[model samples]
Target: MTLASSLLSAISGLRHAFFTREGGVSQGIYESLNAGIGSQDDPVHVAENRRRMAEAMGVAPADFLSLYQIHSPDAVIADRPWDTATRPRADAIVTRTPGLAIGVTAADCGPVLFADPRARVIGAAHAGWKGALTGVLEKTLDAMETLGSKRPDIAVAIGPLIRQRSYEVGAEFVTRFTETNPSYAGFFVPSERDGHAMFDLGGFIRMRLEHAGVETIDDTGIDTYSDERFFSYRRSVHRKEPDFGRHVHALVLEAD
Candidate 1:
């Protein structure tokens, strides 16, 4: 029900998981393990699903924190747990506080977990195209730095999301990126449809991380759009489904 990163799993006092939609009470499009508090799934089921995730991470259910996720470049520091009604509105969260499982929810957007084992600091970011373009990853790194994590010492794991082969975009979508920097054009290639291209979001994310001096990055390379194991917003849209489930990718600094 969960996927672990080899690099993150090797760490002594850190726990992380890329949860799948396999276990839960929600049915229909949100069938099981939909951790999104914002989703249309029944509140009771969502709570129970998240409770299971928190238990797996060895944290109290209330300690499993997630942001409101506005798809912005904002990152916040989580010094303590906050209830869903009072969760902060941001794209990323970083913390040195042990036992607090900071996480981010996503269906097609990138869910990146970061950690600096030596400093006992960890972070989670929701990087959709907008957040990624606006520098959410860099902002997350900066937040982690404030919590005593150095960029060079941090290892990042890119979890499940829609991949390039399943992602096609229009001319304006390509232009929005290339217009930012001409070199950004290489991240895309011609698609079968006219005035469209297949964009490599994972590659783009890696480039941003590398440019920011994060040398170690492990990508799960799982495409949500094609993978039946996870939910996909794009796939749901394609099928005209009302909504989709969201996977919660989290990281925790365990208490000694």
Candidate 2:
């Protein structure tokens, strides 16, 4: 329910939401507001949850769309809604089409929503460590440019994800980032555990967007790992739960 000043100021006409795991019918591990179509939650419950999300965005249920999300750098353009069963395998989606809400699913991973109201273009990306390191955010901006969006005009909001203090990683994970660019090394800090580091996922993402020339970037700064309102895969793993829920971050370009 949080709003980014940049996004709201720049794209006053767009409808967007960074949903938490708090208002759906799924029970137990999937407990409430689990919008992930790929999750093991009941199909009926998932459908109803998605319906609520779409309704909140002021779009029809059929117009709310999300991808299969393989955590790769791949990005696709969505001009129309696709059946859930056949959703494309991609980590990002960009669209200039109105009345269609484009979204990405995430638990601990970064869910970023983008918009350039001047160009009437909007984009959503699922940025896990793999996707972020591999350039999913940059690719999303490039795709928006292709749709006539100026980089400076774009306002991006990085939704809730695991914050640095809660995101511990192995030494190899630190090496993977440093190996790409030594400058990325700064994003990691020493953890309590030996040979481990805590990476600032949100900070790294903000740098990427800034380097790509996006002038307005808003980070929700909510840590999914600690926030009970949001679902987190790492939290679920640590708790030894069977499955975790997923949150949906969506952006819709309303019809004129």
Candidate 3:
């Protein structure tokens, strides 16, 4: 498990974890600790994996919540656990409800956990390039605000994701960002491959948070693409593997 020091020091009375792929029953490509309910991994294996994650967070397995992420900027408020069959199609989730844990899944994509202890509000977002560029982070902060969380008081931790060194983008990708905001050019640097550039996803995500008025932001700085202990969608694709595992980053507001 990886935790952000800033989040730990600033936000009290919350439980969170950026679970690695080292503690579950699944084997082979899914390996162990794969918590993605959407993957083709056997439901039993996924269930057991999620149960382990929930136990680690000190929440009941039934109270651990995740969404059917579609790489959209949509955010939903989770007042209670939803059935797996009805998972909302959202990239972020915010809640003030204690005892319920909200989480987002990511392989190479960014998984961010947010907490405003004073307000007892917490959020989790799945931010890939699309979601981040489309305002998922901002929407997440906005959702948290609706539940009484102050942006300045909210501490966010950027969990494991593909770092810039491992993330390469084509010319069109660069154009998409630059066209959105020419200043975004700073986030890209020329890669060895012609017409391609390396993207600083972690830095971009942090910048978005800062621009959104968040004062305490922590980035784990772990690269999923390079670390075998974590899952990476790109890595799976490069190897032509059938499927990829998903890591769970969750935050819970402890019951008073």
lDDT of 1 by residue, 1-256 (tens): 8998898998898899999999788898899899988889999999999999999889999999999999999999999889999999999999999999999999999999999988889999999988999999999999999988999999999999889999999999999999999999999999999999998999999999999999999999999999999999999999999888998999998897
Model 3 bad stretches (over 4 Å): 1-6
Query: Positional deviation of 71 in candidate 1, in angstroms?
Result: 0.6
lDDT of 2 by residue, 1-256 (tens): 3334455545667888888887789999998989877778998999999999999889999899999999999999999889888999999999999999999999999999999978999999999999999999999999999999999998899999999999999999999999999999999999999999999999999999999999988888899999898999999999998888998889898898
Shift in Å, residue 79, candidate 2: 0.9
What TM-score does each of the candidates earn? Answer: 0.99, 0.97, 0.97
**Which one wins by TM-score: 1 or 3?**
1
Number of the predicted model whose TM-score against the real structure is largest: 1
Model 3, TM vs. native = 0.97
- lDDT for 116 (candidate 1): 95
* lDDT per residue as tens, model 3, 1-104: 44545555456688788889998999899989889887889989999999988998899899999999999999999997898889899999999999999999
Lowest summed lDDT over 10 consecutive residues: which window, candidate 3? Answer: 1-10
Best by lDDT: 1
Return the lDDT, model 2, position 29.
94
